[model samples]
Target: MSTERAREGLYSRVQQFHAEQMQALDSGRFEEYAETFTEDGEFRHSPGRPPARTRAGIAKELTAFHQERFAGEAVQRRHWFNMLNVQEQADGTVHATFYVLALLTRPGERVPEIAPSCLVRDVLVEEDGRLLTRSRRVEHDHVPEA
Candidate 1:
């Protein structure tokens, strides 16, 4: 395959991982969502919180967040990725950044409310021909990094 074709293939796989992750999170399959990362992948939900790197740690945090976010509420949640930009870095890792919209739909609500929108940067690496998130950072709007 030509270099261009190979690049396109890589892009497709990354997008697939992103899409699958969204589905898993939205459907409340927290463990499945965590599985999208590498074995030692890390996530920093906020600057203050310590990163979660272990598989069990990832699952634990995700489950806790989901429960707290939807506590005592019957609603559907969705993650929308906008303007995704995926690039191949010189170091052989893929850098993906995009605006993320966290939407919540409550009972009797016609439109989903935007809980928040943030910029997410994901460092991805191909493991055994599949893309996995090596690390992720999220920045909420107007929140200056410390």
Candidate 2:
């Protein structure tokens, strides 16, 4: 395939992966959310923090974090991604950067809390003819007050 086509294919695969992950999160399907990553995939909420070392670790961490943070709170979270840039590596891996906007809706709340969009920096690998995330770093434009 041409370089352009290859890049496009890689981007499409990554987009699909992100979409599936968001859908799983929105539906509260923790298992599906966990399955989107490779066995050794990493998920980090911020750039300075250490990434979850494995898929199981990520799943466990996220399940606990979400349950505690959103306990008994009805809310919908969606991630909007844009400005995708990808670079193909010699080892059939891709490095990507994309901006993301996370929208949160609370129960009976007409307006959602719009977070300052963040950037998603990720390393993707083609394993067994399928694209999988090896690492993901999320960097916020401005840290929100807790």
Candidate 3:
């Protein structure tokens, strides 16, 4: 494949990956959310926090986060990612940056209000014809007080 085509393909897959992950997590499908990553993928939410380094660990964290933040009957959250940039890395992984947002809807809400805005960096690898996240770094732009 031409280099440009290869990048386009990878970029598409990465976008799909993020979309699936967001859907799974938003719908409380924790296992599906974890499956979006490699078996030993790393999810670093903050520089000072320990990374979730395995699928099980990832699921655990997701469960906790969802329950604590969005479990109330009146609260709902939608996660979204827009591909901002894509590039091939020297280590045979695809590096992508996504403009990420989490919006919350409450009981009286007409539309979801944006809460957390971030730039998410994903290092992705192809495994068995499926793209998976090897590592993800999330940097926040704004986080409204809950």
Q: Supply every candidate's count of residue pairs whose N, Cα or C atoms clash at under 3 angstroms.
A: 0, 0, 0
- Rank the candidate models, highest lDDT first: 1, 3, 2
Candidate 1 lDDT over residue span 1-146, tens digit each: 56655455666777788999889978988788788888898998765778888667888998877678678888898888888898999999999999988889999999889857799999999878777888998888867778
- Segments in model 2 whose C-alpha atoms lie over 4 Å from true places: 1-8, 47-49, 144-146
lDDT of 2 by residue, 1-146 (tens): 56655444666877887788778877788767767778888898755656776878888877887898788888898778898898998887789899999888998999999886898888887777877778888888887533
lDDT of 2 at 59: 84
Model 1 score (lDDT): 0.85
* Model 3 lowest lDDT segment of ten: 1-10
* Residue pairs whose backbone atoms clash in candidate 2: none
All candidates: CA RMSD (Å): 3.5, 4.6, 4.9
Is candidate 1 or 3 superior in lDDT? 1
Q: Give the alpha-carbon lDDT of every model.
A: 0.85, 0.80, 0.81
Best by the lDDT measure: 1
The worst-scoring run of ten residues by lDDT in candidate 1 lies at 1-10
Could you tell me the TM-score of candidate 2?
Answer: 0.84
Flag the better candidate by lDDT, 1 or 2: 1
In the predicted model 1, the residue pairs found to clash are none
